[model samples]
Target: MDIIDLGMGNPDGATPQPVVEAAIAAIQNPANHGYPPFMGTASFRHSITAWYQHRYGVALDPEGEALPLLGSKEGLTHLALAYVNPGDLVLVPSPAYPAHFRGPMIAGARIHNLILKPENDWLIDLAAIPDAVAEAAKILYFNYPSNPTAATAPRGVFPGDCRLCPQVRDSVGS
Candidate 1:
């Protein structure tokens, strides 16, 4: 019998040659053996800032704003710890990456799941959220190229379209 396995979302192929080579080179460097800086290296932060500026024509301060995390999971959790207060409401789309909800969970925030419908191209219906919930929500989480669903938000879905719901205080996009 043939069985299909689908739990982990790891890529099915080997790491690309360039990425593998870079990782190997980094590991071989004696300077990289020690524990990394808490906020990431200055060079990495600078690179990120430069990349953002180049890609989006937006300027970011490398020293103050560009933080490099080990991964999105750790970053999200830390963000939750920093921003969420106990009993605060967090709006998360359903069928989301586990970390999106887990971070808020660890922060003791109450999660209000917004169901992503196929009809809406997996986008949450912000209007469907009750006025009370929307008003009380501290954070609204969104993801493009969504895990599991692989849904991508249409252009102008954020900032432009999001302004329609003004009650939401903060939003985190992944």
Candidate 2:
């Protein structure tokens, strides 16, 4: 029987030649053997900042701004672990990457799932959140260009003043 597997996030094709070559080269290098520094090498951090500058026209201080994580899912989960105490309220969009909520779950935080609907183009309706729930929420996780749904959200979807952080209005301009 022939089966089509779509659930796994495997690439449709073999690894690109340049990438494959680079990986092989790195594996052969003695310097790449041991575990890297916790924050990654200064060169790697600098490269990240440079990429941000080139791609988004954003200037970042490599030492302070660039964080080289093994993967976004792991980083996001660790972020929840770092900030969430048991019973803290976390707002998570349903139909999201499992890691978005899994981290908070592992931290023993109460999850308030914001159900996304096709009618809303899979966008989170910030206005739909109850005032009380918004006020109590400690962590709010939202994904744009969503993983499985591939839904994109407009900038206007985010209000200037976040209910969780009223002071962020100035920082997050309307």
Candidate 3:
């Protein structure tokens, strides 16, 4: 029997040698033998901050605005956990990825699925979410380079901070 590998829609790429060596070194270090900081190590955190600064030209405060996580997927679920209380409405797009559903499901959340038809170029009309659902919704799960469908939405689809809605964690690969 052939075993089908149905991923939770995660990227599959080899860790670069340099990154692997660094992880090895950190593991070998006696200082790292203990529990790691909840936020993460200063070196990695600084590296992340530097990336955002260099790419976006925005200096992030590592202490407040930035904290490193094990992975973006885990961080996203944790975001749902932090903000989405039970019975809170989570707005997700139709024909979506699993985590976009699962995260809120595990958080005991109800979804207000926003259908995205091809005619609209896969962008949601903010006006479409039912007035009651919009008022109740706590978080919106979305993807830009959409999974399964591979549709790319417009930049102005969501508001100023909507960039983060599907910003860092929604990528998928083989």
Candidate 4:
């Protein structure tokens, strides 16, 4: 039998053998059936922080900074609902995954779309953002290896003071 996954970005292929074996093993274990902690398991959080430290040399506290979510869409939705108020300005890149802007829209935020241009290799032109807009924006959603466009920004693209933006949430590898 063949299976076709016509779902959102799912690969048209069989499940990897190792992953399938792992799933079978987990399903057979009673401990794996229960719900996990809301903040995720300590080991998972520790692993996340450790990955950050190794990959980017950034130190993060597992208990305080690391959060393991089911997926990016769900997490971003909750984040927007929790932080953004009605009419608050949010900066979202144009031609992005719906989740990038949908959450803010649902929160009644005023979205300012950052246009990605082929001339700029689809990267957001940080310098072009007006001073007033930058200052007024409540949150900026940035994605690299961007959805649809496949754009990637170089390291150090963000300014030291975050280019005067108050909150920047980067959704990498989306």
Candidate 5:
């Protein structure tokens, strides 16, 4: 018998030498030893804001809008906690990363799984969702270069012509 493990998303390769070296140096710095700020150091947030501005031409306030998280899972969880309310509907892509669903679950939000079908290039078929569910949804979670499925949304499919129902207050994409 042969075994092939595919459930985990760990990288197949080692970290780049420069990146590892940089991490080691940062860890060794005396200035880096203290507990980090709750929302991350100002420098980290500023760097994130700057990257967004450079990559997407979007300006974000470092102090108010930008936050550095341990990882996307934690970020998504916090986002759910911040926006989701009990009885609120959360639209999530089916076959999504576990945290996408878990966050809303922890927030007591109703989970509305949007099926990502292969016929639609693994994108959610908005039309398939019931109008009531769509109208009640408060948050929509999407991930491009999606985990497990490895699906990529076409250009303009997100943050473009996509017209989520008016009730949607937050759309998180990673």
Candidate 6:
């Protein structure tokens, strides 16, 4: 019998040449023969810095903020471990990536789930968050380019407010 495999998240197009080339290079590199730095490398961090400064016009101190992860999922989990404390409140959006929920649990934080519905254009309602939850929340998980739903938010939805500080880390992702 002929068996076949199926998967999700595979690229619809052929793998790009540069990425293929990089993979070949990694296979041949003596330096990558073992486990690389658990925290990633300087060169990777520098590239992230360049990308942030050039594309986003956001300046980041590579040494301070550039974190190269195996993938965003693992990164967020470990990040929660680093930042969250026992009994601290975490705000998780409904219909979110499982890691967002699992991360908080791994870190021993209490979860305060808030529903994000389609009628709101998938934006978190500043109004919808309960006063008690908002007051107690120590982390907020936001995802855009949202999976399983294509909803996008105008930058206007974010007010650039600094006052939501004590409750959240002001982080967003996709």
Work out the TM-score per prediction: 0.80, 0.81, 0.67, 0.79, 0.80, 0.73
Q: What clash count does candidate 2 reach? A: 0
lDDT of each: 0.81, 0.85, 0.74, 0.82, 0.81, 0.75
The clash tally of candidate 4 reads 0
Q: Score residue 57 of candidate 1 by CA lDDT.
A: 75
**Maximum-TM-score candidate:** 2
- Residue 18 accuracy (lDDT) in model 3: 100
Supply every candidate's count of residue pairs whose N, Cα or C atoms clash at under 3 angstroms. Answer: 0, 0, 0, 0, 0, 0
Show where candidate 4 strays beyond 4 Å: 1-8, 159-162, 165-174
Taking the tens digit of each residue's C-alpha lDDT, what string does model 5 give over 114-148? Answer: 88888898887777778788778888887788876
How do the residues 59-172 of candidate 2 rate in per-residue lDDT, one tens digit apiece?
999989988898888899999999999999999998778888899999999999999999999998888999999989998888788765679977667777557545444544
Top lDDT model: 2
The candidate, 2 or 4, that scores higher on lDDT is: 2
True-structure Cα RMSD, model 5: 4.0
Candidate 3 lDDT over 53-73, as tens digits, reads: 888677988777788777657
What lDDT tens digits, residue by residue, belong to model 6 across residues 92-118?
877677778899999999998867788
TM-score, prediction 6: 0.73
User: What ordering of candidates by lDDT runs from best to worst?
Assistant: 2, 4, 1, 5, 6, 3
- Residue clash pairs of candidate 3: none
Q: Which pairs of residues have clashing backbones in candidate 4? A: none
Worst 10 residues of 1 by lDDT: 165-174
